[model samples]
Target: MQLQKLLSLIRQAVDRYNMIAEGDKIAVGVSGGKDSLTLLYALKKLSQFYPKHFTVCAICVDLGYDNTDFTGIDEFCRNLDVPLTLISTQIGKIVMEERKESNPCSLCAKLRKGALVDEAVRLGCTRIAYAHHKDDFVETMLMSMIFQGKFYAFPPVTLFEDKNLRVIRPLMLVEESQVKGFVKRQEFPVLKSPCPIDGTTKRAYAKELVAQLQREHPGTKERLFHAITEGKIEDWALPGV
Candidate 1:
């Protein structure tokens, strides 16, 4: 989980998916979590010498939760020299109070991502970087199959044609454990999520299930990731291919 190894994995994903191009400005979604912070750190380092010459900034969609301090994240970004944007929204109130939906993760995510995308577009960014890693990739695929009856996971690079923006996952090759190790080792300022139901979501269940499978049979995560990348799922193909 060293910076050099992390950068190597990120570069592999970027190269394999044609994620970066010359003059690309990427807005990284930083949730103040380990994964996103690791991504911001790695991408900042990568941009220092990446041949494609892309620039990166950090964005965090604040869900209007009380007592949530972003001071640590602010300093964290300043130290990395990456511009940070904090978009405040009433998503928490809308999802948890007004709608009161039994499952709020879906609606909350849509609102948060919509805010992030709109801001990224307004900032003239060509792409948005999400910190989804190998474990997220596998869990999402499992969630889709179990809940939605589909064998689909998000692609490494997704193009939003209408908005003229793309979503890229440079940490697609990194593991969640590695990300935790990286953030802990670097002593980066990590913030706990402000959501009321932080770890009780369906995705959390899927994560535990995946962990159980891995414990029973090693390399389970690797196989699931392989299936996602090489299973010929729609839109899973490489960019422009």
Candidate 2:
């Protein structure tokens, strides 16, 4: 079932980004969302059949929510034999108390990402895997072009300045709908975000725009993904030949 899709994604990421090696310890950042949870489950399933000598551990950053309980995540990881590390941080408090701003996603994301990177390095992980799939990349591309006037999006793989950790997106080839379908089929446990501004955010607007475009133009998503993978940026530098 999903094993095939999971394997295909892993293989595509490996071929595209050279993500895995003979022996690598990869740390997956899980936020208990559909994307991160699906990624962790897929990676755990793929680990059994993958020939690479690598391992995966799930890391969750609890952003200081009093009512947020991680029991579901803990049970899921335990059943899958995957170790889960939950780090408690005062991100929510900081965002709500200190930041006198309407939008909190930017600040909260930056702090959480910094914490994740530091934790990955401290855990001796060579690679940090995220669950940014095709839809996320597409939304980012659209956002950059429309707002920032730049034709840039998140890359599949990037190396940090320290040269000790490599950031990789294994689900870059997977679609958001596919991941949701997989989750529904598997009946995976999902925890709703406890953030104060979860759905009413700018990213949600970008998501809605893309969804509308996708509805109007069938196969638009696939075409955009192909453009990303097949287009040649270097050709822009050359003169008309």
Candidate 3:
């Protein structure tokens, strides 16, 4: 999980998907979590000699929670020489308090991403990088299958044609475990999530189930990831045929 290994995996995903272009500006959606922070660091390092000559900045959508500090994240970006734009919204109040959603994750995510995409557009960014690693991919596929009766997971690259923006997942090849180890090794500051049901969501259940399956049947996680990449699922294939 050192910087070298992290960059190697990131470069692999970026190359495989044709994610970056010359002089492209990418806005990294910084959630101030370990995964996002790791992505910020990895992309900053990669930009140093990526051969594509793309620039990176960070955009954080603050959910308007009280006593939630972003000073550490501000300093982290400053040290990395990356500009950070924070979009503040009352999403927390609207979704959790006013709406009182029984299932709030869906609406909350929609609002947050909408806010993030708007800011990226305002900043003239050509693409946005989300910190969705391998575990998230697997867990989301499981969720889609169990909840929606479909074998679906988001692709590594998605284009918002109307907005003229592309969403890329450079960390798609990295695992959650490697992200944790990278954060620990680098002593990066990780902010605690302000969500009331942070670890009690359906995604958490899938993560736990995946872990249990891995414990009972080794290589289960790897096989699942491989299947998603090679299973001919729509939008899951590489860039070219």
1-241: candidate 1 lDDT, tens digit per residue: 7889999999999998999989999999999999999999999999999988889999999999999999999999999899999999999999999999898999998998999999999999999999999999999999999999999998988889999888999999999999888888999989998888989999999999999999999998899999889899888675811
Scored by lDDT, the top model is 3
- Better candidate by TM-score, 1 or 2: 1
Which parts of model 1 have CA positions greater than 4 angstroms off? 238-241
Any idea what lDDT model 1 has? Answer: 0.92
Residue-level lDDT for 178 in candidate 1 = 92
lDDT of 3 by residue, 35-124 (tens): 999999999999999988989999999999999999999999999999999888999999999999998999999999999999999999
Task: Spell out the clash pairs found in candidate 2.
Answer: none
Model 3, residue 238: distance off in Å is: 7.5
Which stretches in model 3 have alpha-carbon errors above 4 Å? 237-241
Report the C-alpha lDDT of model 2 over 68-87, residue by residue, as the tens digit: 98999999999988898898
Q: Determine which window of 10 residues in candidate 1 has minimal summed lDDT.
A: 232-241
Query: What TM-score would each prediction reach against the true structure?
Result: 0.98, 0.91, 0.98
Model 1: clashing residue pairs? Answer: none
TM match of model 2 to true structure: 0.91
- Lowest lDDT sum, 10 consecutive residues, model 3, at 232-241
